[model samples]
Target chain A: MIHLLAFGMIADVLEHPEKDWPWSADTAMLRAALIKAYPELRDLPFVIAVNMDVAGGEQPIPPGATVALLPPYSGG
Target chain B: MKNIFIQGSIAASFIGESIAKHQSKTDIGAHAIFLGQVRADVIDGQPVSRIDYTAYEDMALQKVHEIREAAFDKYPLTCMHIYHSLGSVGVGEISFFVFVSSAHRAAAFDALREIVDAIKADVPIWGKEIFAEGQGSWKVNQ
Candidate 1:
């Protein structure tokens, strides 16, 4: 299982901030699967981070790695 | 990884104490501070009463430290401190604080702005604006 961390509106949609889900081959697949599971996420703009580093492209998701779904940062 | 999250709105006395502690650093000739207050924004006819902030703690610490290091490298700063609210902050309350000190005023001012801008853009934190009637929406940086 891979770890997933969702924040902000995405977390509200997911109903929980953290989860362990079946692993996907790459970030593209992960994004697709998450949107499928939570259709509400399709309309939002966000980025994926793998193990603390923002994913630049469709990269492989190492087993047991933590992935974060980050929305537009509103921090000050 | 230093935790910069404060439990709620930062108190004015806390800010004053922070300044007082720096008095012993005689070499520092200038200090620049930026405080972010929760604005009473009216969105779609509803007035926002407060803001509730949250963060991915592990990532925030890492990101904030990197920001601090970058500021130090680019500016001759004597020291820097950052604190942000983690829970509900009422309108007009201070939710963010950035303090930078240097031997001269220029470095302190420049670094302070850069640091604040970077934190707003790069940190994995979020704020949910709670309307006076109790509805809330996630806020996005402009």
Candidate 2:
């Protein structure tokens, strides 16, 4: 299982800020699965981060890795 | 990681204290400070009276660490401090503060703006605009 975290609108879309999912794959696959699970995610803009680092492309997600879905930053 | 998240609005006294603490470091010739106030915004006739902030703490601190490192790498900064509100901040209250000091005015000024901009663009923090009567919407940084 891998730990999944979400923030902002993405958390609202997922209905939870963090959770554990029984899935282990690269960042791209996780994005697809998430969009498939929650169609609302498809309409939202966000980026995937693995282990606190923003994934540049189809970055691999090692087992037990922590993944985060971060929406556009609104900080100042 | 260094905790930059403050529970509420940043007080003027706190800012004064921060400056006072730096006076001992006489080598610093310039200090640039940036404050982000929660503006009372009107959206669809609903006025935003406060902003509720949130973040992924670990990730945010990590990203901030990176930003801090990059600034130091690129600038001859003597000191840099960043603080952001994490809870409800009322309109006209200070929610974000970036303090940068250097041996010269030019580097301090440039680093302060870049650091503030980087936080807005790269950090994971979010602000929910709470209007009067508690009606709210997500804030979009322009």
Candidate 3:
């Protein structure tokens, strides 16, 4: 399991195995893997974007990859 | 070459040394410096005391590189440096610093302004304003 670094909110990997990621999982099987591995993030109000693209459908985060969990940016 | 971002607090010595390093170039006759300081502002009947900053580091570094390139191309600048805080900054603490050196006053002045504007608009950073009374809110540049 890769250490997911999120700035604001915590993501639970124990609750949802078959469900797609909050944003998008790259592969159908990978989506299943995430939910199975981290089911705790299944119901959170969060969005996942890769390279700033919000992945929404059945895409899984590429295996062995790291991504930023950006909710929104507001700074002066 | 001095990297754009540093982990420690920005001291007056850092600013002075950065300027002194470029002094060897006699062609550079002028240097402009800008520092952005945090202020405790009242918001919704609460007083803000500090800020916590975070960024999309990879994206921010890329944007800084692009700004440096564009600044040199658009103006006759000998060199420049930009620094910003990535973590918590209290009231009266400095958060942003931009320094520009050029052959003349006009170019340095213009380039300094451009760099600051670009940093505010292009950088993927976020700030949480901490209030003196123990409350906070997300802040956006106006």
Candidate 4:
């Protein structure tokens, strides 16, 4: 199992960890973890804000300390 | 410690109060201020009515603290402040205010521009443009 966390919006997953995130796992396993976290958002249009800019365009999130799901900031 | 975030219809008063609190010092030769206001504009043929701003406060505060340190190191400034709105700001309303006080005009000008540019490029605030023509779009400081 992998650790996953979300802010601004939740992910689209059917089987979320239901526990703490930022855990460890391999690349494929973590993507599975993300898929589990937000089943609804899976394969949907979304962006991640690592620090200030949008990230994770097409690739699965890298297993590291510099990754975040950037929920679309709709507030003006 | 210093007043940074201002909201609602009273933001102007807050800006005024901040300015009033500044006393001209004989050692400082220049004081520069920049205020960014919400403007009604056209976006992709739609007219924007206002903007709503949101941010990750924890990260933003960390960035702001770094900016302060960098500004003082780069410029001979006595003090500086940055204020940004947290919610919706209607057209013609002020959304951001940056103030810089330095011992010289050149340093103050350079520092002011740097601060604004850094905030635009590095801050984690999101801007949603609400249109008067009944449409809207998300915009990031680019």
Candidate 5:
């Protein structure tokens, strides 16, 4: 399983802090699955982090890798 | 990793103590501080009462570390400290504090501004503005 974490507005939309997906999925596939499950996320801008690093869409998610969906920063 | 996050609104005493700690460094001639306070902004006629901050901790810390290194490389500064709130901070409360010291005044001022701007833009921190009416909205940086 691949662990997924959500933060900020993305968390509010997901209504949950974390979830798990199939480890075979790459970043692109995972994003597609997320957009399918949470359609609102499609229009919102966010980035995917794989193992605590910002990842491109093509990055593969290895088994047990920690992934996160991060929305635009609002910090001062 | 040096923890830069405070759990709630930063206390005035903490800021004072931080300043006091630097008294032993006599070579530091000037210090510049920037404090960010929560404002009660009215949105759709509802006043915001507080802000709840959250972050992707690992990534945020890494980004902060990079920012610190870049600052030190770009500016001639003796030392710098950055503190940001991680939880709820009420209106009129301090949320962010940036302290920079240098041998000269010009470097302090310039480095302080650049560092703060970099943090605001680069860090993976988020703020949710809670309204007086119990509703809240995710804050968007403008």
Candidate 6:
């Protein structure tokens, strides 16, 4: 299983801090699955962090990786 | 990892104490401080009462560590401290504090500006501006 975390507005949309998903080799497929499950995520400005680092959609989703959806930062 | 995250608002007493703690370091000739307070911005017809802050803790810590290291490399500084609130902070309450000390005023001023700018642009912290009536909107840095 792959663990996915959400923060900021994305967490509000997901309604939880983290969620589990069946492992998928393709990063694009995983993103698609997520958007399908949470339609509201499609419109939000965010980035995907794989293993605590920002990752591109083309990058492979490593097995059992910790993923996070991070919204644009507003820190001062 | 260094403890930079504080819950709720950063108090004036805490800021005063931080300054007092540095008094023993007489080598430092100048100190610079930057404090970020939550503004009561009016949106539409409602006014913001507070801000709810959140962050990806591990990543934020790592990023802040890198930023600190970079700042040290680029500036001549005696010490630096960065503190950010993680929970709710009401309007006019302090949400972020950055302190920099150096032997010269120039270094302290330059380092403080650079550090504060880096934190705002690079840190993965988020803020939700909550209105008086319980409604809120995610804050976006301009």
Candidate number with greatest TM-score:
1
Give the best candidate by DockQ.
1
DockQ agreement of candidate 2 with the native complex: 0.86
lDDT at A30, model 5: 84
List model 2 lDDT by residue over A24-76, tens digit each: 57887888899889999988989888898886677888899989898889987
Off by over 4 Å in 3: A1-49, A52-72
Query: How close is every model to the real structure, measured as TM-score?
Result: 0.98, 0.96, 0.71, 0.70, 0.95, 0.96
Which 10 consecutive positions of candidate 2 chain B have the poorest summed lDDT? B130-139
Look at candidate 4 and tell me the lDDT of residue A21. Answer: 55
Instruction: Give the per-residue lDDT digits (tens) of candidate 3, residues A1-76.
Output: 3324454332223322122334334535544444575575455333444444445554456544554444455544
* Model 6 spans with C-alpha error above 4 angstroms: none
Cα lDDT computed for each candidate against the true fold: 0.93, 0.92, 0.68, 0.64, 0.91, 0.91
How many backbone clashes can be found in candidate 1?
A: 0
Computed on C-alphas against the true complex, the DockQ of each candidate is 0.92, 0.86, 0.30, 0.23, 0.87, 0.87
lDDT by residue for model 2 (B1-142), tens: 7899999999999999999999899999999999999998899999999999999899899999999999999999999999999999999999999999999999999999999999999899999998898878889999
Runs of candidate 1 with Cα error greater than 4 angstroms are none
Q: List the residue pairs that clash in candidate 1.
A: none
State the DockQ, from 0 to 1, for candidate 1.
0.92
DockQ sort, best first: 1, 6, 5, 2, 3, 4
Error of 5 at B54 (Å): 0.9
Q: What's the true lDDT of residue B137 in model 2?
A: 87
The best-first sequence of candidates by lDDT reads: 1, 2, 6, 5, 3, 4
For model 4, the stretches where C-alpha displacement exceeds 4 angstroms are: A1-67, A71-76, B1-3, B133-135
lDDT of 5 by residue, A1-76 (tens): 8888999989988998898866656788888988988999999988888898775456887789998988899997
- For B1-142, candidate 1 gives per-residue lDDT tens digits of 7889999899999999999999999999999999999999999999999999999888989999999999999999999999999999999999999999999999999999999999999899999999999999899789
RMSD of each: 0.8, 1.2, 5.9, 5.5, 1.4, 1.3
Instruction: Mark the regions of model 2 whose C-alpha exceeds 4 Å error after superposition.
Output: none
Q: What C-alpha lDDT does candidate 4 achieve relative to the native structure?
A: 0.64
Per-residue lDDT for B31-95 in model 4, tens only? 89888888777778887887867666655677678888999887789889888887778888888
Candidate 4 chain B, poorest ten consecutive residues by summed lDDT: B1-10
